[model samples]
Target: MDPLTIGILGFCALFVLLFIRMPVGTSMMLVGAVGIYMIRPQASLPVLAGEIFGEASNYSLTILPLFILMGNLAGVSGMSRDLYNAAHSWFGHLKGGLASATIVGCAGFSSLSGSSLAAALTMGRVSLPEMQRFGYDNGLATGAIAAGGTLGILIPPSAGFVVYAILTEESIGRLFMAGVVPGVLLTALFITAIWLIVRRKPEKAPQSVTAEPVSKRMASLGRAFWIIGIIVLTIGGIYTGVFSAVEAAGVGAFLALIVTVIRGAASWENIRDVSLQTLKSTGTVFLILFGAFVFKTFVGFTGIPFRLTGWVEAQGFGPTAVVITILVAYIVLGTFLEGFAILVLTVPLVQPILQSLGVDLVWFGVLIVIVLEMALISPPVGINVFVVKGIADNVPLNTIFRGIWPFWFAMLLAAVLILVFPQIALLLPNTMFG
Candidate 1:
């Protein structure tokens, strides 16, 4: 069979495996290995060994564990609750204020934790019951938390950007810098969506009967200063050229550990649990990354990226149209596939096309992360939705999905703005890196 035909069949087989409930990493690794052996039996084993070793020994990947540990440690230090309380103190008086507070809390936590699931889980645990007590609609409450959690991957220290950077051979720092403006923009859009929702239907999120006292609000903000300080020191250090991305991760993790200990929150049990969670998260990410590298190798052997790039050039589609097409494909695939899985599966094929179009990858990285945020709330396989549901089990799955739509559309709008004005993604990166 022609290499393109082989590539197509390999992708088909991959989907079948995924449909059968195979783990994404294992499925990709299996399909990639089998395809490589089919095409070049003599090289398959060697390729597999080399890929595994390369991934294992990769210095760049050390940042993953450090960042993951930093997040887990911060969670154990009561920072998530402090963040929520601080936001609620400031915004809880407005219509849909609790929901807005949830978004703010999520954004703050996202700056600490780069994993969307962590943000959703941590903020959902802290904010949902309070919103429920205030007579907030289940959909609005859950939706805000889920949507807010998506910011975890768009803000600095984002695992999504780290994975994208590794896959595309782009600079992780540049991708991170690229994400800052878009991340803040999305957070604002999500809060605006909440306001619009509550304005049209005030009953969805009833106003707080009494505003927080100024003294109490200031106290809440003071309590959150540790997390805010850590975020500034690390992310700010990166922008100021004081630390590489990896150095930032190490510093953040170490500082988080120290704070936990000083706060008397780092009991032996807490320490052990944090360590274990970090290990589990790191292992899962590394497994998927290893599979991604192998799968990319297989795709390279098939020459699909080149052929696809040629075909797109032949068709003469404008760059904007090509980008829109890719975004649409990502949204559709995101409904069925986990965001990282989509990243790993498609970047190999799409990278060449985008590069050929002279598309700035730093910009594309932010754009793709935004779509992935949408996917986290997209129904059927909305992982963040599921994470929220796990915590708020009384809310029906459909209601959680319903709540996410406003925020999802908010995300869609963010993506559109970024597309129309690439500078939204490029400004910080260029200014800082140049």
Candidate 2:
């Protein structure tokens, strides 16, 4: 009958719903509604309606659709292929070069598409066959693509960061800026992991018979210049304070449309397809956010976050110990939960605890995104691995899972470095926003 008891039962019921294959957003909404009604009968329906209107009318969330549109347009314009080709021209001759190139290409595409599934699906389609043609082992090839795709949520324009910012009421621009260094650091670590993999098992990735000529490589880079320019124009504009994150999203989407047209890739069918896909993705995100807000409100009413924070204090856990404990829980949850689900489900409970500990939120955002990145490749429900498996249908699930280990470890290293040196996540945001 107590609020905390109601909250506990609600969570158990919510997980049972999830186990029965209910949609996350709907499940959250249902549990939250029932919990609210149980706690206060008259408040439940009005609160649900109010939260829906609040999330729907939020002006800051305008960035979501624009960014999603930009990514969809970029995908339709063949930018992912161009990025992969340019990376291949530069790195494809080295041991494990194609796999390395795949990581680089994923990083590049991540700048364009902020969704991990989009990055994984797009790059997996573009890079997998090329690696196969070159006789790269299926595990190494698919693993690189799967792991690399996780970069999409850590790089600028990241939907993960956007959701985090929205949930925490932090500055989205600052979060975007904060993600930059850590994203590049993770990319480099992924490439290094590939190098180590091939060093130990050279036969996994065959050396190219001959490297491409400098002129050809330069030409390939040229083909990718438009995408590079769009990235600079949007992300660079934000860094220099010339454009807000929302404005950058608009301009980026517009430019992507222009480039799509110029490349003669814009047909009625392509336009229709991209538009519909964007709508579907955007709708899904909004639904999740709506559920998250209602669930957050219910949790707030229960006062669980405050109690948890108090419990931590009573335990005399230092800030470092508290953070480690939270992250370890995240790692365990990441194995079974989708990244966004992990985020929306936990952040309402966790944010106050971190804030009470005087943790820098922007730095914590970067760290959280990295863990979410790790989730994308974790196991069982590692969605990025599934995305890769969808593309490389013949590659065994275990092989792809095996391949992602090194990159997953690389992600773990990135998290550790960011944890040790918060500057790795904070420098850009501070330099730009302060």
- Return model 1's CA RMSD, one decimal: 1.0
Instruction: List model 1 lDDT by residue over 299-414, tens digit each.
Output: 99999999999999999988889999999999999899889889999999999999999988888889999999988999899999999999998999999999899999999999
What is the C-alpha lDDT profile of model 2 across 137-239, one tens digit per residue?
A: 9999999989988999999899999999999999999999999999889899998998898999889999864799999999999999989999999999999
Model 1: runs farther than 4 Å from truth? Answer: none
* TM-score for all models, in order of appearance: 0.98, 0.99
Q: In model 1, state the lDDT of residue 232.
A: 95
Cα RMSD for candidates in order: 1.0, 0.9
With a 3 Å backbone cut-off (N, CA, C), the pairs that clash in candidate 2 are none
Q: Model 2: runs farther than 4 Å from truth?
A: none
Candidate lDDT (C-alpha), each: 0.91, 0.91
Error of 2 at 382 (Å): 0.5
